[model samples]
Target: MKLHYEVDGEEFAAAGQASGNIKKMLKQLGIASDVIRKISIAVYEAEINMVIHADGGTVDVDIQTDKIYIALKDTGPGIPNIDLAMREGYSTASDEVRDLGFGAGMGLPNIQKNSDFLKITSAVGVGTTVEIEVNL
Candidate 1:
């Protein structure tokens, strides 16, 4: 099955809607609870990043019999250093965003930890695309 979600950058309150929806769908589909939990957390963090950093983005999810694939694409100021961005506690979120308790820089690391395969591509002036997969 394939699912696609559009994430709005202006709505912090609704940032995790897509992830929540996916979680529910996964439950209805009889996916393992642990796997669903991990996917939700990872996707939630990515959604927040898109909202806070990028203006907005889209996520595509493909569910296979043995694995799940997720792709998050954003047309925002891309990461200049993937290595630094992967580190926990490293954030470029603005003060306003930080005041909301959103950006602690755990997004990428958590995504990496949860996924069996992860790939990130970013161009400083262009955008970023993150591809992650978790095997069942």
Candidate 2:
């Protein structure tokens, strides 16, 4: 199966809607609870990152019999340093974003931890694309 989501840049309150929908779909598909949890957390973090930093984005999810793949693409200001961004406590979020109780900087690290295969491509002025896969 394949799913697509559009991350909204204008609404923080709607940040996790796509992730929530993915969670429900996983449940209805009888995916393992642990797998569903990991997907949920990773998607939530990615969605929030799009809303908070990327301005907006697109997410494509592909579910296979032996793995699940998630690909996210954003046209926002891309990461200047992919290495730094992957660090658990590094963040570029402003005080406004932090005020929302986000920007703890755990997004990429958590996604890596939960995914069996992960790849990130970014350019300072261009954009970013993150692809992650979880083995079944």
Candidate 3:
């Protein structure tokens, strides 16, 4: 199965909509709870990152019998320093965003921890694309 979503960066309230939908689909498909949990967390964190930093993005999911693949792409200012961005507490979120109690800088790390495989490609002046896979 394949799923696609458009994340809206302008609306914080809509951030998790895609993730939530995916969770529901997983449940209805009778997917294992633990697998569903991991996918949910990964997607949610990626969604939040897109909203908080990427300005907006696209989420694509491919589910198969033995593995699941996810791709998130954004046209926002790409990470200038991926190594630093991977740090658990490093974040570039604005004060206004932080005031909302979001942007703890744990998103990417958490996504990596949950997925079986992960890759991130970014261009400082262009955009970013994150791909993650989980084995069944």
Candidate 4:
């Protein structure tokens, strides 16, 4: 199975649309609850990041018999310090966003925690791409 989604930038109301759809699809397919949980969490965090930091992006999901692969690509300003970005409780979100209680700086960390494998590539002036793998 394959799924593709485009996240809208700075759209808090629609942040979880992709993740919610993926969750519904997984449920309808009778996927393992634990696996579904992990995917939802990872996808949600990635999706939110796309809207909050990346100014929107695309997510591609490939579901295989033994594992699942997800890729998120963004065209926003690339991550300046991956290490800092990965750190828990570290954020560059504006006060306006913080007021809405969205940015706790745990997006990437949460994705890493939920996926079996995680990879991220970014350029200062280019963009960012995140890939994730989950075992069945």
Each prediction's RMSD to truth: 1.0, 1.0, 1.1, 1.2
Best by lDDT: 3
Per-residue lDDT of model 1, residues 20-121, tens digit only: 887788888898888988888888888788888998899999988888888999999999999999999998988898899877788899998887899999
Q: Give per-model TM-scores.
A: 0.95, 0.95, 0.95, 0.94
Off by over 4 Å in 1: none
TM-score of 1: 0.95
Clash tally for model 3: 0
Error of 1 at 102 (Å): 1.5
Q: In model 1, how large is the Cα lDDT of residue 21? A: 85
| Candidate 4 structure quality by residue, lDDT tens digits, 59-98 | 8988887888989999889999999999999998888888
Q: What's the C-alpha lDDT at position 119 in model 3?
A: 94
> What is the clash count for each candidate, in the order shown?
0, 0, 0, 0
RMSD of 3: 1.1
Which candidate do you rate higher for lDDT, 1 or 3? 3
Q: Which stretches of candidate 4 lie over 4 Å from their true place?
A: none
Off by over 4 Å in 2: none
Tell me the lDDT of candidate 3: 0.89
